[model samples]
Target: MARGAIPPLPVWAGEALDLITDMPSAEDLVTAMATQAEGALIRAGRR
Candidate 1:
C-alpha cells in the first residue's frame, strides 16, 4: 500500500479484523473528552 493509504481488509476477515483494530472516529473523541471532563467535575465537587 502507498504511504498513508489504508490497506483494504480481506472481505472474509474484514469484520473480525475491524473489531480488533480500528482508528477512533470523531464521536469517539468527543465521548472520551466528555468522559474526562465529567471525571474532573466529579473530583472538583468532592474537594
Candidate 2:
C-alpha cells in the first residue's frame, strides 16, 4: 500500500457506518424520545 493510503474496513465496521449514516441526530432522537415519554407519563397521570 502507498503511504497514507486508507486501509480496508472490516465488514462490521462498514455496516456500522451505514447504520450510523441513516440515524437522526443524537439531540433530535433524545428530544423526541423524551417528549414521547413525557406524553405517556402525562396520560398515566404520573407527571
Candidate 3:
C-alpha cells in the first residue's frame, strides 16, 4: 500500500473498510465499539 492509499479488499472486508472510513476519528470508532460491547454484555447478563 502507498501513502494514504486504500488497498483492494474483498467485498465483505470492503464493506467494513467503508464503515471505518466514514468514522470521523479512530477515537470515535473505539468509543462506539466499546459502547456496543458494553450493551451486548449487559443484555447477556455478563455485566
Candidate 1 structure quality by residue, lDDT tens digits, 1-47: 57978667685488777876787888898999999999998989952
* lDDT of model 3, residue 21: 82
- Best candidate, lDDT: 2
Q: In angstroms, give how far residue 4 of model 3 lies from its true place.
A: 23
The C-alpha lDDT values of all candidates are 0.81, 0.92, 0.87
lDDT ranking of the models: 2, 3, 1
Model 2, 1-47: lDDT tens per residue? 68977767786699899999999999999999999999999999999
The candidate 3 region of ten consecutive residues with least summed lDDT is: 4-13
* Deviation of model 2 at 2, angstroms: 28
- What value does the lDDT take at residue 13 in candidate 2? 94
**Per-residue lDDT tens digits of candidate 3, residues 1-47?**
57977667586698999997887897887999999999999999999
Q: Which regions of candidate 1 deviate over 4 angstroms?
A: 1-22
TM-score of each: 0.48, 0.54, 0.51
What is the TM-score (0 to 1) of candidate 2?
Answer: 0.54
